[model samples]
Target: MKGRFVTFEGIDGAGKSTHIGWYIERLRARGIDVVQTREPGGSALAEALRELLLAQRMPIETELLLMFAARRDHLERLIRPALAAGQWVICDRFTDSTYAYQGAGRGAPGERIAWLEAWVHGDLQPDRTYLFDLAPQLAAQRRAAVRTPDRFEREDTAFFERVRHGYQDRARADPSRFVVLDGEQAVSTLRVLLEEDIVTLCNT
Candidate 1:
């Protein structure tokens, strides 16, 4: 049997991590064979690379390359194996993050990113992706309150705004696979919306 792959993405402090847990709970309750994971740090090597990528001293280009490298490892090792066994793969972030942070935010060439994605993913794409939408300033404020900033979190507001818009552009281009949800709302409200969306997906 084929498996479903879903990914969640957003700028820092968009509540994706928090809500992903909620979605996992829902899936598990429904008896789905779910595998919850995150990008840049799923396998051991990838997790180690995550620390290096998120370190304060790394250059932006190096960070982008490391992110993709971690993703490549994740796909080949964990993601592909789990999906082949007919398990739902729920990832916290994926290639959309590269386009947002590297291409749009860091001014890398979109064509190059596209080529890399094509080479790595082939026909593999998320069956569904939920983008937690929020203003960059609001997200920054949330991040500041929660914990110390990572390398990307400490970036300037202008960069984050570009990332935000990048996510919007990707979602607009692929509405069939991407769902944009308001991140400013209460957690319960967002959960209800997500539940509705899941019901719609399951029925189709």
Candidate 2:
């Protein structure tokens, strides 16, 4: 059987970071062979792009292109291979982030992102995408004390508002593949829901 591809997404501080480890631990305990990776930093080349993407300012088009470039490398070098070998690939973020951050947050055209997705990724899509939904104001407040904000993190509240909207739109359009989870809920509660969902997914 081809392994499952699961990607977790959300705005900067929407509690995804807090729960991912716990989720992965449970997945591993269930005897799933898991490969935990992250976007823009999965492979060596992608990590380089991740650094540039987070530190440099460029045109929205440029930023979006670089993101796809890294993704191509990540998919080819790591993600595809792992899944082909029957190991579940759990990614921290993926193309959805590009749509939210570059397409919506930066005002890049939807057509442009669509074009790139087709050309770069073919028909590949996540088996499941969990969105940790939270308000931008609350998310920003959670991360206020973090040291040395990255480019995306440094963006003002309005930018994140657009990003949050972009993610919500994605969830609405693909309800079957996208799971929208309220980020304000207690981690324990969310974990239970996540585990139940994953159990169902794996059984299927």
Candidate 3:
């Protein structure tokens, strides 16, 4: 059987990262083989690109290209192989992030992103995507309480608002593939809900 591709998405500090490890543990407890990874990462080359992408300030078009370049390397080196081995691949973020961050936040043309998406990994989408939806202000507050902000994380509230709307738009366009979660919910409550969703996905 082919393994499922699952992704977690949200604006920075939306709390999606908090559940990733727990979700992986849950799958392991059920005897499922799994590979946990994140975008602009998951492979050595991609990781190198990740550091540059996170810390360096560059043109929007350059940033978008680098993002997809990292993704292409990640898919070829890790994601595709893991799935072929029947191991579930749980990624922290995916192309939807590009649509949100680069396309919406940076005002890059949607068509450019779409073209890159097709070129990088055509028709290869996550079987399930969990989007933690939160208001920009709340997310910003959460971010401030955490570690120092990175390049993308340092964006103002307006940028995050655009990104948040971008995520919502993607979810609306593909409701069947996205599970929109409320980021403000209690961690325990969110875990219970996520557990149920994981169970259903595993069974399917």
Residue runs of model 2 more than 4 Å from their true location after superposition: none
List runs of model 1 lying over 4 Å from the truth.
none
- Prediction 2 TM-score vs. true: 0.97
Global CA lDDT of candidate 2, please?
Answer: 0.91
lDDT of each: 0.90, 0.91, 0.95
Judged by lDDT, which candidate is best?
3
Task: List clashing residue pairs in candidate 2.
Answer: none
Q: Enumerate residue pairs that collide in model 3.
A: none
Q: Whose lDDT is higher: candidate 1's or candidate 2's?
A: 2
1-204, model 3: which lDDT tens digit per residue? 778999999999998889999999999999999999999799999999999999999999899999999999999999999999999999999999999999999999999999999988996989999999999999999889988999999999999999999999999999999999999999999999999998889778
Q: Which candidate do you rate higher for TM-score, 2 or 3?
A: 3
Q: Candidate 1 lDDT, tens digit per residue, 13-96?
A: 999988998898888887778999998889888999988888757666777778888988999899999999989899999999
Please report, as a residue range, the 10-residue window in candidate 1 with the lowest summed lDDT.
56-65
All candidates: TM-score? 0.96, 0.97, 0.98
Model 3, C-alpha of 21: deviation from truth (Å) = 0.3
Per-residue accuracy of model 2 over 1-204 as CA lDDT, tens digit each? 669999999999998778778888988998988999998789999999999999998988788889999999999999999999998999999999988999889999998999999998867899999999999888888898665678899999999999999999999999999999999998889998999998889888
Q: Candidate 3: which stretches are off by over 4 Å?
A: none
